[model samples]
Target: MSDRAAAFHALHRPGRPLLLPNAWDHASAAALAACGHSAIGTTSLGVAAASGKPDAAGATQDENRDLARRLRELPVLLTVDVEGGFSDDPAAVADYVAELAALGVVGVNLEDGRPDGSLAPTELAAAKIAAVKAAVPGLFVNARTDAWWLGVPEPRDEALRRARAYREAGADGLFVPGAPDDAVGLLAAQAGRPLNVLHRPGGPGLAELGRLGVARVSTGSLLFRAALGAALDVADAVRAGREADLPDVPAYGWVQELTERFRTDGHR
Candidate 1:
């Protein structure tokens, strides 16, 4: 494994979960790295929305690639969310991920949720995972099943079943987003790999998730949505002539300096 891939894999330790924040662009990623985030992921929704396209509909493959290229210059490990691998064909999915790996991405999140609100076949998902691992053995493949996210019947059973298949297919981690707090430990214990859960606000904190045997906790699109909401709230407050009640915002010069350093230094 490459050193970056090894470092990223080492971050997924049970009982000491890595809180991974997803960034939408170079500025957000550079800022996160500036704040000492050793690793950062790209949010598919954020990337698509920023490019005036839809998320999870295979509309942002090029956009994702471009973003990955930009983020490669940052001093942080990057894991991209390539929704459905941007294709159904296993070989195509593998090729796309291989390109990302070539650009220095250490990991990727490949989900089974389709754009039509239906889960892809379990075998197909497993095939994608297997293909990706075969193509880039060092790339950490976080195989995500949307049984819970899609509100399928008996999600726990479905998730576990899929988890077993993905594990057999060489998945490095199992991501069951929308799995409830009650079901986390069970999934973690039985998934046979590092368990990754999406972070839900007002839900169990990171410490609690670590105790539940979760190795990685991803913010997913939550940070992007929260950022949009905050921007709208600030705009509304300013329009209503009210002081924006917000945390300390980064100064304009600070952001410029952040990007400028990356531009000149190439990579930290």
Candidate 2:
């Protein structure tokens, strides 16, 4: 395996889940990397919304690749979220994965959810996984099932079934966003791979998730949403003539230094 891919794989430790905080753009990614995260993921929703495009509607392929190329310049492991691989064609998806792999992306999050709020047939999803794995053997393909997120009947069972098929298809990880904390352990036990769960603010915390056998916990657009919420809250606070309750906001100089470092050392 490639050294970067190996590093990313090593981060997914069962019972000691890696906290993958997803970023939207270069500044967000650079800020997260500056805070010392070993690995960083791009949120597809963030990318789409930033560009005024709909995510998972096959509108962000260029955005995904562009972000991947930029994020790869950061001094950290990087993963790009390629929603449904941007095409139904397995070979096309594999080619996209190859492009990302060439840009030094260590991982990818490929979902089986269609923009129409339905699940792709299991066979097709599996084929995409297999193609990606064959094309970029070193890239960690986190196969995502939206059964639970899409409110599919018997979501748990469906997720598990798809997980099994994806595992056999060479998925390196399994992601079930919106999976209930209660069912998380069951999925983790049966998936036969590292289970990645989206972190809900009031749901099981990281420590609890680790005990449940989750190997990866992704912020999954939460940070981007939180940032937006924070901005709105501050705007409202200012309108109401109340001080914005901001905490842990980094200094302007620090962010400037990060941008400068990127400009100077990003080439390395």
Candidate 3:
């Protein structure tokens, strides 16, 4: 198997679905890697915000590529969120995917929802998937469907239709961030490809997710938002002369240890 394909499988540990954390920058991705994560993902929201662009709007294509180029040197495997493939033009989308693969990224998440909160045509998305695969045959495409986000009947039938189309178009797997747990089996069975679901708060944990046949679990923007919120809370608490409620926070020496580890490996 290819290195990129192996990376994706390395993420899925049988009973344990890949608890993929989405990082915004090198430090965040490195911090997670230091904590023993085998792979990392980039959040579209974080990427867009970092580049001063709107998320899911075909914005920040260059920024995303730049981030991937930087993260390619890191120890962990990287997957990128290319919001709607960064353009409506299939050729442009394929070019973007090709760049990402060249940067050593193994996987990508391409959504089907437009910036206007409407769903793109299934055929359009299928074409995007095909174009990307043609541009980079070994790239793992996690075709994302946002039917639930667009406020429809959740479009199980439509979702299945799109899922099949993407699979035929060479998508390696499928991601439905807002997929309901009750219908998880149905989705997985129909997908033919592995079903990837977002890790929802107070929802099914990793074990429960595996039982539902979820092959991958993505912590979309939750980690980034939580980390940002924690930093702000601690700063605000200090201003109020109060102690922060941060979890067993890493110490200065422990953080230096990460740099040391990388430095020893010549990544310094």
| Top-TM-score structure, candidate number | 1
Report the poorest 10 consecutive residues by lDDT, candidate 2. Answer: 259-268
Q: How do the candidates rank by lDDT, highest first?
A: 1, 2, 3
lDDT of 1 at 100: 97
Report residue 135 deviation for candidate 3 (angstroms). 1.5
Q: How well does model 3 score by local distance difference test?
A: 0.84
lDDT of 1 by residue, 1-268 (tens): 9999999999999889999999999888999999999999889999999999998899999999988888877899999999999899999999999999999999999999999999999999999999999999999999999998899999999999999999999999999999999999999999999999999989999999999999999998998898899999999999999998887799999998998877634554
**What overall lDDT goes with each candidate model?**
0.94, 0.92, 0.84
For candidate 1, the C-alpha RMSD (Å) to the true structure equals 1.5
- RMSD of candidate 2 to true structure, Å: 1.5
Q: Return the lDDT, model 1, position 61.
A: 93
lDDT string for model 2 (214-237, tens) is 999999899999999999999999
Model 3: which ten-residue window has the lowest total lDDT?
259-268
RMSD after Cα superposition, model 3: 2.3
Off by over 4 Å in 2: 264-268
Please report the candidate that would top lDDT against the real structure: 1
